[model samples]
Target: MNFSSDAAILYWSGSNINLNFKGSEISAILKDSDTANYYNVIIDDSIVSKIQLNTSKQTYLLASGLSYKKHKLQLFKRTEWDKGTTSFYGFETNEKTKTLPKSKSKKKKIEFYGDSITCGYGNEVQNGKDSGTGHFENNYLTYAALTARHFDSQYSCIAKSGIGIMVSWFPKIMPEVYDLINPNDPNSKWDFKKYTPDVVVINLLQNDSWIVNLPKNEEFIKKFGNQKPTEDFIIKSYENFVKSIRAKYPNTYIICALGNMDITKEGSKWPSYVSKAVVNLNDNKIYTHFFMYKNTPGHPKVNEQAAMADSLIAFINEKIKW
Candidate 1:
């Protein structure tokens, strides 16, 4: 996050700006790189509305007609980095109402490094046509976010739509962008000590399964020229990525997760690959948890995402000391 000129830049999915104030209404000064970005206006702990951003800087009406009492407001970014960045200026309150400091954050912290599943892509879709505007993506409704809310843990997400461990829909994989403070800036480094998570969940490999199969795909060709990565190569790549994360958070529990996609399907080998990587590490702290395949077209919907959160919570309860 870059806080300059009395404003901050929210560049990734799930990033937010929270304010507590006593007023009947409140508005925010904001700007978006893309005019079509989305944001969830959460009052207190419940989401009240989903607002779209404009390309130019302006004051956006967040909430109105509330009791003239203290209220908590959280503006959560719903889209990922590729959706665009948001610049937040400040909030405006009616009358003599003043802004108050937010409540203390939870001591338990969890960091998620995943893909579209964690970004809640296609979550808002109903019957057919599994695609929509960026409004369809809501990070707050994802299994990752639900899991964090359940544990009352501070959430840190670094996820993109088509990212994977071995290969992505794009040339940049998780290993290359995991440590950057800004996803698009290779020179930017995230200070590990700034926020050390007690638990790190890595949900990936769904994209790799498809992309690696198409060895001639642009993404595959860019990541691995001419040759398709063998099973051994895939397993090794997953291991190396986890090891790099372990090097950063030595004592933190690392959950090497796969997905509710074809990656974890009945006959799929991605689960075995993740299990193999965990066995190779031989570290008691690192564990494997794979969500069952949804067996439907497109991404997992909200209910499916909820099921995943429930499964993950159950796994965490049984395996870890959380």
Candidate 2:
């Protein structure tokens, strides 16, 4: 992927991802196998980078504003399956800032996994707060994109809105919507061997609690072969999701981010019941570490997104040596 403008600062987020440049432009290359995927790149606050691919090895280039300052990068894997890997590679134009110290070996990769919040669902200006008019208007300025850009000048995003860890609230929707909406169909199957991220961040839960007219625990088990996604179910489902990712990316770092929404709070205005099931899942050893709620409103606003980017940058610095 490449930025449209040379950036004084840059930010990106994705896994099994890579980057290179030609002249004043930067290029981000997606090595993942999926024909479809999403990537977000942010430069300062004015430029938002969003990309959707229907072909393999998607590449993007940004023009102008090339700088040497430290930037943030946040990469997300929107689909539960088809999780691509990402890495950073490029030349250092400025000597003022310390670069990664050139190495011939390949760099590690990272990924962010989550639902609408991580996908920046309602973050953009929309009709009503709940109407969902901004569905196609991708917010490249979202926290995930900002965080990735801060970490490295190269990154990608694969997150989607309204997604769940086990089963999506949007019935009939598949996990690979980040790539192709019908990626599993015989006409559009996606391959996952191409891209791989060293780190994976999983953020889910809000939508899992959105099921309406949920059945009683016993009834749910009889119908769906499991509890009705109560707190325990949520934890178990998340645990399983982690296990699956681990199976695919054995050495990858996993970070589970608790959402910003207060769905678990008591007597909240939202009509849905909050699922406190996975609150304890935050401490599971399967995760490299977890970040608790920052008490920000519904999807993060611009300022809130910036703060999120800062926190993620700090987390990356502390955890990953790169």
Candidate 3:
């Protein structure tokens, strides 16, 4: 996507900022048939920005001179369909300067890894909340994106709806484990190198608990090709997932989040549980953080997303000390 604006530049000297969206597609689902649809971008509760596809590429222009210690950008797609795919990228500059600075501290990357809530699903209301079945607002107001904007950090999101730590509603899929099922092509294996997350935040398990449907008291084993994720199995799988991440980005920070979709009510407690487990395994090397549900009906509301960003910023403040 290409973004440019003739308006005055906006600037911020803060360390944390967030850019959120509602219609970002990480996994390639079938494209929705709606071609006339466009996405909306909102900054800091006002200043609406519109994104439309120009030929094969999507583009947008900003109004300029917008500044904030923490800025929020949201994107929602206006369409009559269930699902579509797109990615969002943004840049900032000072009003007096034509370009942004190229300092090391100015370049930080955060990656969000999770399921539907992270994907910003069901965030839009259409026809009094009953008319639009799968319609999403495609707003950047999601917690992950908003948190990034709050930190003024660069970001990438790798999430899908109905995915879980052990199983998923989508076929041939497993959560967080390496080389499991391939949603793109069931017969093919996934390559992790294509997209590596810097700071990984996982929020899976809602779908796992829902689909398993076993007695709440019964212990289920995660069945992968030949392996089943028993409590022990899951713990080990999480370790392996973290190991893979460390192998890829040895200096990366892994933050595992719980309770976004209430997977605790179902059966998946690994995100919360694994936070403790990984801490025990790596001690001070791996920093773990947990977030409780923000009390929204199905997912987090806008205020909840802002709160998540605040928590993250607080954590970074205590650690980075700059």
Candidate 4:
């Protein structure tokens, strides 16, 4: 079965489409652009693939070798519009397929902001040494998404692989791009009224600490420009960023989160900066949480991500009571 029309376009982050069919194989017709985008391929209720859309118009095989029976498929865009946008031309199945009714909106909503950790970079790597990009990343299985699903809540993940609050691996910081519909383009602004989350989680500072503390990060330093890049500067920048978010969502519960990576000795003081920012803001609605650092060579795997989500779920339950 193949279906295509101009009315099948979905244009937003975390947008999803559902298909109900009885077939052994199915493929999605996607029209993509240069800036890589990702989609979650869920068979039944389990995610089986994190397909990357990096080409022009093409037909990508989603799943195959399944038993011929009635099954449900979920296609979700994991990356934001900043990376690029793709169109779901439709799905091709062995048997006739029909679109399923849209799921009802959840009562609770969450917004996660961070870097690769929150993006689930390298989460699928089994060799522990594989490190490039794409393929291994799966935002659908990320701790943030998992936690949202655990609570049966709707979620929006606004994250890039190497972004930070003060210093990113490149030039763009979260403050500069947080409100942008397209993080890659400064001109693209996202209206605050679009979607407000009940809880806003900030898991940042990892890349900032790593890049800013370097003896000579010429790239970041050059981008840092005239501002004196110091520990105080980092702390102040973080505070200002949080203040901006608080201003936007006055009633939203803000969580200052860090870790699941190094945070001891010189690095240990970083999380404190986030805490001090929340305290200085004098907001009772804001809180801080940290994940214990477990020595992992690469990004957290599926099991580790699950544990992270469990911790977050417990905290959210205690804090927001949702």
Candidate 5:
């Protein structure tokens, strides 16, 4: 988030603001890159509404007719960077409302570096188009978010749709953009010491599975020199990416995970690539896990995402002490 200005710019999915206030209604002074961006209006714990942004600055009515005693409001960015950026100026409440003092606490941090699955792409759609409007995406509904919420962990996500470790649907891949504060700005850098996670999850390889099969893909040729990447190359690429992360946080537990996609289908070699990479690293803190394949087309739906979260939450409870 760019906080230099009065209107802080929120750039990633699940980037959000929480307000505790005693009021009958509340409004927010916000603006966006465009109308494509959407935000989840969460009161207390449940999501009450989803809103879009406008080009011009305006006060967006978030909720009304509250109990006027105490309320927890979360204005969360549900869409990804591609959906457009949002600038938050602040919030406004009715004349009788009183803003509560900010609370402080230390919480365990968990960071996720993944693709569309982590971004919650198409989670709301029911057998809809492969790519729809921003309406269908909700990062808060993803397994990553669910796991974070389950442990009351502070969350940070560096993810985009169609991205992989080796190659992506576009020319840019995760390795080239992972450290960036702004994904499109290669010059932008994120200081790792600012937020270190006790547990780090890397859910990738879905796009790589599809892109590698398409030898004619523009990005494939650009990355693989007009040939499919070998098994050794793929494993090495995974190793190098995980190694880069370890270099940043020496003691953090790294979960090198793959699939809930065809990448983990019965005959697929992608899971092996991840396992072999972890084996080759010989790192005690790093572990590999593969999500069960969905056995259907398109991204995982809401129920499927819940199943993934359930599986992952169990894995975390068993494998990680923190």
Candidate 6:
């Protein structure tokens, strides 16, 4: 059967499905046939459970131990497209089920832009080694998601593994595809008007620091028209990118953040560059923050992500008061 025909797709990290039912148990017919993926089963907007999606399982019980009354269920795909796509055939409830309209999201909304750290790459791995697989990824526990959930706000995560502000591990950089609906598809375009966040957080520059010093290929040079990337060049590129985002979101608060990686190290010079870019932009609404953290191997674990989230949440609370 063509599974995609009848089912709603949870294609990327942060994609989700919601339902309201009057039942004690709720289950979903889900399939993530290739790579490992994860889902956040949120019931009644309070109780949350992390479920692992695998090829062997066709039906996943999202919530079983619930009181027999009207309740709300939200299933969030906590893994990126690289982890694989999940198809939700439908929901199964012991009693009568009612389809819920996609409720209007919270009045407050936030969007995050970055790389592996924002994507929660390898965050679930117990070992520190970069295993280079989807099994270790769990975007649900990332700092970005944690902060949004803490505020009971809506969120969008436009992040991927090894992506940078100016240079990515792959061919595309954040600037080139930030407007795309599908992070992996070059032809896709996202309409910024569909949902505007009250605040925008930019946590890039990690990969640029690592890749800028290296020799560039002919294609890379042609795309950027810069063979030797200097500190000034990086700052200017970043400032321009922020301007582009501002063009789309004129009044939104923009926070340029760095670290939870080596970007905080004095020698890295990344934090300085980010600060300089925001200063050069000269927008009082745009701010810069540096996270003092160790450059852990692979990615940050849950506890580490929570620490990052706490710091961010504290700042947003102070600055935006939301």
Report every candidate's CA lDDT.
0.88, 0.47, 0.50, 0.76, 0.88, 0.79
lDDT tens digits, residue span 7-65, model 3: 21111101122343222211111122233344554555563655443324323444344
Per-prediction TM-score: 0.97, 0.55, 0.61, 0.84, 0.97, 0.88
lDDT of 2 at 79: 29
Candidate 1 achieves a global lDDT of 0.88
**Candidate 2 on 81-184: residue-level lDDT in tens?**
33332323333333343333322333545566666666555565443243233333344556665666565433445555666555554442324343332323
Candidate 6 off by > 4 Å = 1-5, 45-58, 98-104, 216-226
For residues 129-166, could you state the per-residue lDDT of candidate 6 as single tens digits?
Answer: 65556666777789999999998888888888888777
Clashing pairs in 1: none
TM-score of structure candidate 1: 0.97
In model 1, how many backbone clashes occur?
Answer: 0
TM-score, model 2 to reference:
0.55
> For residue 11, what is the lDDT in candidate 1?
84
Candidates 3 and 6 compared: the better one by TM-score is 6
What TM-score does structure 4 among the candidates reach?
0.84
TM-score (C-alpha) between model 5 and the true structure: 0.97
lDDT of 4 by residue, 91-176 (tens): 77654544445556778889988887887777777887544355566667779989988988888777777788877777777888
Off by over 4 Å in 3: 1-38, 41-47, 50-82, 85-106, 126-135, 172-198, 214-229, 264-272, 320-322
Clashing pairs in 6: none
Clashes of each: 0, 65, 30, 0, 0, 0
Q: Tens-digit lDDT track for model 5 on 39-158?
A: 999998889888988999999999997886888888888888887778899998778989898656447888999999889888889764456468888899899999899989888888
How large an RMSD does model 2 have?
9.6
Worst 10 contiguous positions by lDDT, candidate 3: 7-16
